[model samples]
Target: MSSFFSRLKQGLSRSRDSLAQLVPGGSVDALSEEEWLDIEDGLIMADCGGELSGSLVQQARKRRGSSIEALKTSMLSMIPDAKEINTSENGPFVLLVVGVNGTGKTTTIGKLATMFGQQGKSVLVGAGDTFRAAAVDQLAVWVERAGADMVRQHDGADPASVAFDTVQRGVARNYDVVIVDTAGRVQTDRGLMDELAKVRRVISKAFPGAPHEVWQVVDGGTGQNAVVQVEKFREVAGTTGLIVTKLDGSGKGGIVLQLSHTYGLPIRYVGVGETLEDLMPFNAEAFITSLLPEHAVKS
Candidate 1:
């Protein structure tokens, strides 16, 4: 397997280890109803969310028979599969990446650009976060690292105009992908959200049915608040997908389940570490299995 998958698997293993501590296995047959409630509490503490965890426990109780192994096997099947990207055709697959400030939105874009470029696709980045001079400079560093072209204007330029120019350039050059990096503002801010909508409209006008994907980047460390963030972004930007970052740092990674269940947005990718390759496509089974204790895996 690739190093990215290996790290993903490893990171998941840590999460599983944490989860195992919450759900101790005694023979379920020997446990009281109170014991089962304890197990459910563990799941909730893992950030699995009450609805999903409760549903899972109820299902497990109904189907209980022999080994904890069998129970875990069934439970693993409950998590949804990761979202897959269709990179089949060429000619400008545009991704509009957004997130709140300090959510590592620009860094995620840089990594994504590198990944696409490494796959032999031509990429053009749009510096659409015109409010911050640093945003443009940071993305420029990514452009250089990824060896992809960028569309940028001076600081304080209209972000929608930047997006317009970026899409125009993409169509003219027949670029394989155009990743637009937008400013990460609070989704509740009506003015900023309206501006984002304007950017989308500009892109659509330039290339109808374009802005092929609107991806929201959420910090995994933010816990349940990330869910609120996703909901707000979806309301404003009509997000089609999610990218959860900082999974390697905290035990709150269980928020992935909450995101999948609440938003029904497929997790396209996860940020595990700081390196470019740290980002990996989400794998639900591997992820859930990784959350199990080493002893559970062996048992």
Candidate 2:
């Protein structure tokens, strides 16, 4: 296996082991009613929502074949195909990223810069999360490591202004891509959500149709809560995609399925480890293979 796939398998070991223990050893045709229930329960235990787990179990039961193959088919059908970010616009491609605090939002931005840098694209990052001084400092460190430029203001400065400046600078400097980071706020805070909306508007004003994409970074280990974050952020920021993080050693990998089933938004990337290269572009086949037995697809 390639290094990324190997790391993904290792990262999902906990979730995979939990699922393997629940799957019946023999063929699906021989599965008892209790065994069918066991499969559903296992999915729930892995943080796939109860409704989705039931639906997947029902679909799998209808497909009579190898147990692992049938279950994998059911899951792959639920998740949409992975898609790359749209960066083909005329000027610099701008991306606005938002999420709750402690979800590794800033770290994800840093990794994004590194990824774009490796592509031979110049990256300019905006430290829009000005409420926290540490966030700015942390992003600065990541920007330098990635060899990317950044625009920031003092702590407590207007985040929208910072975003505006970043986009303006990106245009002026002719950077290939500009990524703007937002303050992590609770989903329930209407004021904060309004502020986030303003940031998006300012980015657009700075560059028409800018912020080509708004991606939300979510913690895979947060289970069902991740769903709520996506919903709220999508409402205010018009989130275009997702970047899931903290999957390493997090047995809750099934949350990815739940999110996909819930929103149907493209999963742009997944963070399986702490290293810069651990952020792998979403691969549907590889994800399923890592999370379950690598049985051939049943016709």
Candidate 3:
């Protein structure tokens, strides 16, 4: 296995162990009703939503294969295929990132800027999280480390204005990419969500059809709560994709399946560790292999 895959498997070990106990080496035809029920329960306990777990178990039981192989196929079919972030044919490619507080939204932006820079693309970041000076300061450190440019305003300034300025600068300066970071908000707060909507609108106003992608960064350890966050963010922010972070040693990795199966949104990336290299582009096969036990029943 590649080093990144090794890290992914280790990060998801806790979640895998939760399901492994219920799916020992066995033929699917040999599983008793109680054993099948246990497997479904195991999926639920791993944080796959209850309904999805039942559906996966039903599919697995009806499919002809080793118990583990059937489960893997069922899960792989549920998640939508990963989609690449859009790039503009002309002008800067813009990305708007959103998430609840403490979900590592800022850090994900930093890693993305680095990824783009490594591709020899010029990057500009907008520190639109102006509610906290410390937030901009945190982002500044990462921007400098990535050798990217940034735009920010005084604390309490309108976040939408900051985003507009960033896009305007990116356009006029001929930068290759622009990434805008918004203040973290609780999904239940209507006022804050409205501000987030305004930010998106302002970016489009600055450059027509800009903010090409709205990606939400979610904490992998949040379990079912991550589901609710994604639903709310999609409603107000037009979240097009997901970046799941903090999966290193998090038992709640099963939330990835639940989110994908429920919303059919592509999971763009997963953060398996703290390094710049840990923000891995999402791979369906690697994710499933890391999540499920090997097919132990001999052919």
lDDT of 3 by residue, 69-141 (tens): 8999999989988666788988999999999889998989999999999999999999998987888999999
Q: Give the TM-score of candidate 2.
A: 0.96
Compare the candidates by lDDT and give the number of the best one: 3
lDDT of 1 by residue, 81-146 (tens): 545564426458988898998888999999899999999989999999898998789989988899
- For each candidate, the alpha-carbon lDDT, in order, equals 0.79, 0.88, 0.89
- Candidate 2, residues 1-299, lDDT tens digits: the string is 59888998988888888887787666788888988888888889888889999999899988977778888899999998756667746789999999999999999999999989999999999999998999999999999999999999988999999999999999989999999999997999999999999999999999998888999999999988999999989889998899999887577888988998789988888988888878888887788789884542232
Give per-candidate clash totals: 3, 0, 0
- For model 3, give the RMSD to the true fold: 1.9
Q: TM-score for candidate 3, please give it.
A: 0.96
What is the TM-score ranking, best to worst? 3, 2, 1
Clashing pairs in model 1, backbone N/Cα/C closer than 3 A:
12-290, 16-291, 16-292
User: For every model shown, what is its TM-score relative to the native structure?
Assistant: 0.90, 0.96, 0.96
* Cα-based lDDT at residue 8, candidate 3: 85
What's the lDDT for residue 129 in model 2? 93
